[model samples]
Target: MKLRILGCSGGIGGDRRTTSILIDEDILIDCGTGVGNLSVEEMRKLRHVFLTHTHLDHIATLPLLVDTLFNDLHDRPLVIHALEESMEIIKQHIFNWQIWPDFFELPDKSRPSIEFQAMSAGETRELQGRTIEMIPVNHSVPGVGYRIQNDTGSFAFSGDTTTNDTLWEVLNRHDGLDMLVIECAFSNSEKQLSDLAGHYCPETLIADMSKLRHRPRVFITHLKPGEEDQTFQEITEGLRGFDVVRLHSEDHFQL
Candidate 1:
């Protein structure tokens, strides 16, 4: 399995992008602003997108991608799987006719380019040669992260979570997790805010990492832009026993 980090920043600026990751060439973990970096051909090849939450930084580019690639769909709908609440937010706030033309209904409602499939936590959805499961995480909204495995390799991503037990329990149950793409959105100094927002700071994140039975090559993601260096430093310094590193756009890992 090839994991491509499309974007891994919490906020955007020049050279900084919001969170998104592409699994192989067919599945996208989130369609943040980073999706805009993909070439037209890459855009056309997308078949499945697993959303983390309803946050704009996580799913902002999905609507735009569907709109831009509308004509190229060729009756192929972009299947987006996420928590039912996440889908509801997209439909009500993003894909609503006025906010953006509902790609799920444009050209033709029956043959639209985007389709939202509600996935509840703990549900495993298999497609092609892969198994992708949605699992709960501690986030402000009703959000779930994804753990995907193919015959060859496995990877799990903790989507915008703070600290949680079910995530670790689920990972232990799967037992094949090779890489963990989790988020640490704030520096250790901003622990209060991080907790308030239901995101991980280095301190909280380190504690959470202790729950894992196996030490996967942990790739840290979703740090707010300006805080990158400090957050990275804290995470590296604080997490002395783990293999954690910040992720960036276009970085690829072949597992």
Candidate 2:
């Protein structure tokens, strides 16, 4: 499987985009502002979107994406896989016509342009050959992480979480993990704020890292734009034994 880091930032600024990850050509983990970087042709290839939550930074471009491909989606609608609660929040707030046209009912209900498939934690779904499993996570809103694996290799993504045992426990249950895309959104100085906002600072993230058993190549993501240097410096200092790398937009991996 091939993974591309479309975006990975706590906030956006010049050249900085919120969280979004493209898996191969057909699947996306989140549809953040980074998704805007894709060409119309690239967007057409997308068939599945697995959302971590209903946060604006994560789902900002979803409405636009569906509207842009309205014509093409009539035949093969885009499938949005997310937690039931997250799906509800999106339906009531974003797609309620007041905000944007409800693509779930657009072009007629029977042949809509988009479909929402409510997913529960611990459940797994296989599309083509990839097995995608949803794992519960601690966040300001109802959220989940994902573990995707195929015959060749496997990987996990900690989707907008703070210090949580569920993520580590689920990952340890598996035999092997090739890569781990986790978040440390703030610096040690902002530990209090990070905790309140349901995000990880370097200190909190380091403490939780002890729970994981596998030694995958860790990629630190979602660092606040201005605090990126300080947060990553602390992570590098604390996680000395682990092979951790700072994840950047456009980074690609083949597993």
Candidate 3:
């Protein structure tokens, strides 16, 4: 399986994009602003989207993506897999006609341009050869992380979470994890804000890292725009034994 990082910043600025990841060419982990970097041809290849939560940064481009591909999606609607709560928020706040046209009922309700498939924690979905398992996590809203595996290897993304046992426990059940894309959204100076916002600072994140038994190639993501360097330096200093790297947009990996 191939993994591509479209965006991995906590906030956007010049060249910075919020969270979004593409698995191979067909599946997307989140529909953040980073998706805008895709060309029309690349967008056409998208078949599935798994949302972590209803945060604006994580789902900002979903509505625009559907609208841009409306003509192409008539026959094969974009399938969105997310928690029921997340979907409900999208329906009420984002896709609502007042905000944007509800594509779920657009192009006629009989065959819409997009579809939502609500999934629960612990549930797994198989698309082609990849298996995606949703694991619950603590966040400001209902949230989840995903564990995706194919025959060759496995990787997990800790969507948007703070210190939590569920994410570590669920990943431990798997045989092995080749890579881990996790968020450390703030620097130690903003540790209080990080906790209130349901995000991770280096100290809190390193504390939670102790719960995981596997030592995968760790890629730190979602660092706040200006504080990226400091936060990453702290994470690297604390997570000494593990192979840790700061994730950047457009970086790709093969597993």
Candidate 4:
């Protein structure tokens, strides 16, 4: 399967975009501001969007995406998949008319332009030979990480999670894990803030990473805009034994 990094930064500014990943051409792992980088032609090609949580950084461009490609989606409405709680937040706060016109009601409910599908952790869905599984992760809000695999290999993304056993436990179940895109949002100096915000500083991330049995090429993502170098340097110093790299927007991988 082909994966494209639309954005990987924790916050936006400059060339950094929030957090969004495009799987192949149709599936989007998250709908962050990074999505704006895609052309209208590219947006129209998207059919399914799987959200990690209800955070604005993750779902900021979703409404805009629907609005921009509304007329082109005649074959079927775009499907937005998320955990029930996350879906509730999107329904009540985001898609609500007050914030934005409900695409589910656009043109009418019978022939709506968008649909919400609820998914549970551990559930796996296969689309055109690619396997997508949702694994629960500990975060400030209801969120999940995604594990995508095919016949060749597999990769997992830890969507905005901190120190959590469930994520590691699920990953250990797999025989082969090629890559791991995890988040370290702050530097060691911000350890207290990181803990309070349900994020990971290098200290905590390295500690939790020790629980993993498989050794995948780890790519650090979601670093704070200004603290990128400092946070990554800490990760580099701490995770000495692992194959680690920093994730950047537009990076592509075939696994």
**Can you give the TM-score per candidate against the true fold?**
0.97, 0.99, 0.99, 0.98
**Segments in model 2 whose C-alpha atoms lie over 4 Å from true places:** none
Question: Pairing residues by index, what is the TM-score of model 4?
Answer: 0.98
Candidate 2 local lDDT, 5-47, one digit each (tens): 9999988998888889999899999989989888999999999
The local distance difference test score of each candidate is 0.88, 0.94, 0.95, 0.92
Cα displacement (Å) at residue 3, model 2: 0.5
RMSD, each candidate, Å?
1.1, 0.7, 0.6, 0.9
Candidate of highest lDDT: 3
Minimum summed lDDT over a 10-residue window in model 2 is located at 235-244
Q: Candidate 4 regions off by >4 Å?
A: none
Candidate 1 residue 193 C-alpha distance from true site, Å: 0.5
Model 3 misplacement above 4 A: none
lDDT of 2: 0.94
lDDT of 1 by residue, 1-255 (tens): 888888989988898888889888889998888898899999888999999898889888888888888887748888889888888888999888899987878788778878778888999989888899898998998878899999988999999898999899999997668898999999988999999999999999889888888788899899997899999898898786778877888899997
Estimate, for each residue in 1-255, the C-alpha lDDT of model 4 and write its tens digit.
Answer: 888999999998889998999988999999988999899988988989999998899999999999898897655899888999998888899889999998888878887888888999999888888899999998899889999998988999999888899999999998979999999999999999999888899999999999999999999999998899999999999896799999999999988
**Against the hidden true structure, what lDDT does model 4 obtain?**
0.92
Q: Considering lDDT, which of the candidate structures 2 and 4 is the better prediction for this target?
A: 2
